[model samples]
Target chain A: MQDVKAHALLINEVGLHARPSVKLTQLAKRFAATIEIAIAADGPWTDAKSPVKIMRVKAAKGETLYMRANGTDAEEALRALADLVNRKFDEE
Target chain B: MGEQKNVGIVIVSHSAKVAEGAADMVRQMVGDSVPLAAVGGNADGGLGTDVGAIMGAIDKAWSESGVAILVDLGGAETNSEMAVEMMPEERRERIVICNAPLVEGAVMAATEASGGSPLDAVRATAEELMAN
Candidate 1:
């Protein structure tokens, strides 16, 4: 399939804060893909699959985090990942 | 004790990082479509009597639905139980404490519920997240 690439917002009250960051990391690991999040100026690219990695950047709500996943099922992985962040990690 | 009717997921552990890690995994597997709330603690958050943090999670989730609290016990199991015991009996009934706990269980249950109604998902998925 094609690679999954999209931008999502962190609308949760806490923002990309810690919880959402952690969720993004795990999403990257799920489908055997490379996932990365950029808060603003190009990355601050953490594992995107590791909460620790994502937490490095302090993101607040309403910020745009761009995510991209590329792998075998990169397209599917990206859809789910993008949907998650776009949906404010579903906490919204 | 009224039985679960719309539930939220809560995770408790001495290590917030561990709890956070579990949360991440669960969220990925569960999808962000669900309505879930989580609160964690360090050992100092009251590892022994840390039910407050989990309770807080329940309260947060309560805004959306009932809650199922998951505790990651190292030596804190006893204290965790005590914390839950401290809750008002009425509130206790609304919350289910699963000591068979895995950080994943909470996430799975919460995630499944986030997809829609949590009562059935919590009961079914709480048992075997990997299976479902």
Candidate 2:
């Protein structure tokens, strides 16, 4: 089977603030899939379910984050996560 | 309260720093007896389904009375729901999700109600969310 793929960018003015990160972290934890994400250009690798790691990304405008979810409910998680990154969680 | 139960707390953040930071803050206010578990989105360069971490925290809370999980934004939001979904019908009632602020609301409720059993603390945390 092919790996499920998803991606998101930090577009919020502040970019990945505490509140948004918290909300997103909880969402990702609901599934039974392996999720990993990283800044397309630069930064360290990290799990999607962690705010401390995600916040450390220091994503500015135009920074792209590549995400992949594999296992059960991967597609659902991918879609919502993609939307979250794109929607900027209404922070935009 | 039927019994003084110890509730488990899970703090999820977009990164480890945030979860750690929240954990640190909450640790200070609450007494040492209460069990607290914290997980972040910074594991292995990706973020998704931290089943181990989430389960560990939940288990800690459930050891005695039951467990209540709290999460921040990002993956934590979805993860909380997932944890609840995995529970058996009987156990499902014991797990509580605090959609409110992980750092503030959940911490406050957890600390204040820590005296009661895990179920009491979990209920208190949920009630706080509903009220707020």
Candidate 3:
């Protein structure tokens, strides 16, 4: 499977706070793919499946979160993650 | 998902408000998917750690999967240890006192647990925050 990539804006009011981080990690764990997220396009990424790591990203509102996934379900993982973020993590 | 059980979490702090506040954070972040309990203050309701209260909190948050405890300050940790020691041998084996910050660790641990992660994984997720 080829690596899949996507990006979504952190439009939530509080950005990637604890609640959003937990939602993102929980969603990431559901996929068989390995997902990594970064604040910038080419840079240090953190495991999307780890809440603590993702929370450390501290991506604020208006920041874009770049994600890459590699595995059989990579595409699906990226799509779902992007959708979740675009939906404002279902928070609003 | 209805039958699935997640690892439980217990928060131990010197202040009652702190423990409850941390538990509230966990609930807000992870929802009610994981068992959670908070215990703090002495018998007189002043600032202190109580082993009895800690033990009760452990019981309240008990899960078949296991329970991970997050404590604040040395007194809380020491009392939590005593509470663990006072438990049955089998129960003792399933409880762990995580060395991590109270609020952050509880939230992270509960998040991991809410995903149906194992006790060790939940504890590790919480403890990992200390590194950051």
For the candidates in turn, chain A alone yields TM-scores of 0.80, 0.79, 0.96
TM-scores for every predicted model: 0.46, 0.49, 0.94
What is candidate 2's lDDT per residue for B15-131, written digit by digit as tens?
777777878876664445567767766448455446556766676556346666667666676777776777667777777776567777655545534545346644554455445
Give the poorly placed runs of model 1, Cα more than 4 Å off: A1-92, B1-6, B31-35, B42-49, B74-76, B99-101, B118-121, B129-132
Q: List ranges where model 3 is wrong by over 4 Å.
A: B1-4
Q: In model 3, which residue pairs have backbone atoms overlapping below 3 Å?
A: none
Give per-residue CA lDDT, model 1, range B16-82, as digits (tens).
Answer: 6677787776666555544455555544664333556655555665633556666666644554566
| lDDT (10s digit) by residue, model 1, range A8-82 | 776778877656755665466566777677887466655565443455578787787777667887778768877
What's the ranking of the predictions by lDDT, best on top? 3, 2, 1
CA RMSD for every model? 11.2, 16.4, 1.6
Docking class of 2: incorrect
* TM-score, candidate number 1: 0.46
Better of 2 and 3 by TM-score: 3
Model 1 RMSD vs true structure = 11.2
Best by lDDT: 3
Better of 1 and 3 by lDDT: 3
The alpha-carbon deviation from the true structure for residue A34 of candidate 2, after best TM-score superposition, in angstroms, is: 49
